[model samples]
Target: MADLASLQSGPLRDLPYRVAWRARGVHAGAHRGTSSGAGGLFRDLATLLEAPDPRRLDLRASLRDPFEQLYVRRFERSTAITIYALIDVSASMGFVGNMRKLEVAAAICAALSFSARRIGDRFGVIGCDREIVPELHLPAARARAGAVVAALRTFRPTRRGAGGLVDAAAQIAGRRKLVLLISDFQIAADELAAVFEALAAHDTVPIQLIDSAEAASLPRFGLLPLADLETGRRRLVVLRPSLHAAWQRERAEHEALLASLAARYARPPFRIVDRLDWDRLAAHLMEARG
Candidate 1:
């Protein structure tokens, strides 16, 4: 895992994102909004009486009117939206493999913060374990990336569960937001489902952190020592060919379940293995239809 200084020095790329729904915020920004305003994508022509903006009068439309009613062009306004990184900071996130899960998560938040600010959008972070970590809470604002990076540097995943995600969902109830739900997703199926249900109103993107060393790159036969990060239980087992295959199968099943659940209420889960690939992440964000 890279230290804070190294992480800061790394180049942060702008993450391209899009939303299927129209934004409702009044602030001028990049995303398409429901409001009709002075400059944006042309929506439709309305009678001058309805739009009341003579400056946008359409001469051709007015000439074609039977009643000779004046017409004005209406455009869809671009409005600002809040982007949040809803991170799962459970004990399992502390696991170190080919790459540190928590470190990758922090890098993601920092990139998002930078991207959002660059595009005139508000960015925030909400970290959860057994409960919401107050120190990791950042309200939606056009804040600097340094602030986000600094805050994440202090976060330590010591708690056990991610139940606080549901609570954090409730806190961001009012407006539709772009939520990047980052986690290894080592949680009960029912709990994960519930969290998705709570955040259904928002455009949620589930980013599943993965480390191949955890299961994929295991030796075919060896004495394997494993410890449950959440439960603090240690076990030693003989890793046979059959057991290895079974382990991979179980992991695949779990991923399948998560994908099915995400498809129901959000976009398909984006898997980040080993480390964060900026270009791949940008492509996913751009192409994801949520």
Candidate 2:
């Protein structure tokens, strides 16, 4: 498990974070944007009729033209992206394997916040339990890494309900943002559907944190006591080979459904087990941009 103290110790932490969706903000930053702006990266070249900026004129190309048609360079805008770590601090996220899921969530939040700051983007964190935790909702700002880590350290997954995600989504409704929703996603499909609809306005990345044993490879010979992590309900059942097979099949079906839902929103879900894999996440973001 990554210690919080160590996680926040680096102020210069960087990640190759690329915005997968088009950014709408006008402020200059490091991510690609749809609107063209001054001092932006090269996008393409266009004919004089399309782009009339004399300052961007390609003199060599104009000289080489047989028809003497002028050409101009075009550049894409790089703008600031607001990155919100909408973390699920419900009881389900407290499950432990090598480390608690909540710890993994904290690590992810810390890393993301630090990386966002490194790139001059605004970073914020929202802790969602029974509802969006009022004290844990930090509005996006630059250079708040220390405060964000402190807020993360105060989170405890003690909530027993499953309807907080919709509330969390509503908090970010009016603005375009890059939201990283860290959760186990144990809620009912109907509830999740509602949350998905509420988050349709932003570029949402669902980070599904799972315990290793819960995801796969359970022992099939013993009596296992299974408990609803959120509802405080428990049951004891003999884990026979046939029952184990059925469990595996059910898990596969659920994952398939999640993939389908993410595809519908044009955001593929990323999964991490027992620990937050920062490299994997950074690589996923890089590939997403392409």
Candidate 3:
């Protein structure tokens, strides 16, 4: 753990979002910022109200609205656990990892962020690759949603580039906060464990997001070559029945090792999110909240 973890929440709590009466042109002190108006120190004035379209009928609706829609939502002392979306944009998180894996990870972060804001819990963004992009460091805010969303849009994965995560994690420690680290878990197992060990004092949830291909047995084929996203390293290996079996074994071993370390590291739960099955992971997080 280097100086990266030294980051703090600072006066962010004091510069809370204030409610601006849009129609009356007055400030309603009852609540902080709404999605419609700007309300704090880190906040500039603007109406960032979300206008959902009727065309794109999404079933995530029922839950999304009750938890996310800002229509008449009120901010309360959440007591809902704080969450930090630590996305690993290392090169490996790019292309072959399926169509929108990075986007999926980002989407999850946004979803959680929206939920936190709704429930009055503070949520922050910590995008990590060679280093954490929120380099200067800022406290998370409900009205800062737009800025957070913008930061996530530019994320691109790179190789062996996460040279700063360990340090960054060390800087931000809080009471009853939850750190949701979503990455490919591309680093060495031992190194990964060491960082988690250092942050054991705070609640940290490690969500390792891998592609669908990485999670299952190989496809029926003649030959397949693979490239290492992180190191720009490449090697051509034939896809064979025996080779596939061996691959599964090795992968399983790695998974088991991580599980063991996580179980030992912190009482806070950790998870594995791949392209195929994240429903279980989602359910686990909700349960942890209870």
Index of the highest-TM-score prediction: 1
Q: Estimate, for each residue in 175-221, the C-alpha lDDT of model 1 and write its tens digit.
A: 89999999999887788888999999999999998877774677889
Better of 1 and 2 by TM-score: 1
Q: What are the per-model numbers of colliding residue pairs? A: 0, 0, 15
**Which sections of candidate 2 miss by over 4 Å?**
1-12, 42-74, 215-222, 238-246
lDDT of 2 by residue, 18-111 (tens): 7666777878888788888567788887788988788899989888899999998889988888888887778887766555676666667667
lDDT per model vs. reference: 0.85, 0.75, 0.54
Candidate 3 accuracy as TM-score: 0.61
State the weakest 10-residue window (summed lDDT) of model 1.
1-10
**lDDT at position 219, candidate 1:** 87
TM-score, structure 2 vs. true: 0.80
Off by over 4 Å in 1: 1-6, 217-223, 238-246, 288-290
lDDT string for model 3 (1-290, tens) is 11111111122212122212211213232333323332232222111144343332334543456555433221221123345666677776775434345655555655666566765666777766777666423356554554555455555565466655666676676443566666667666766776677667655667776566655567655676777777788888777788878877877887777677667754334444444233565555644321
* Clashes in predicted model 2: 0
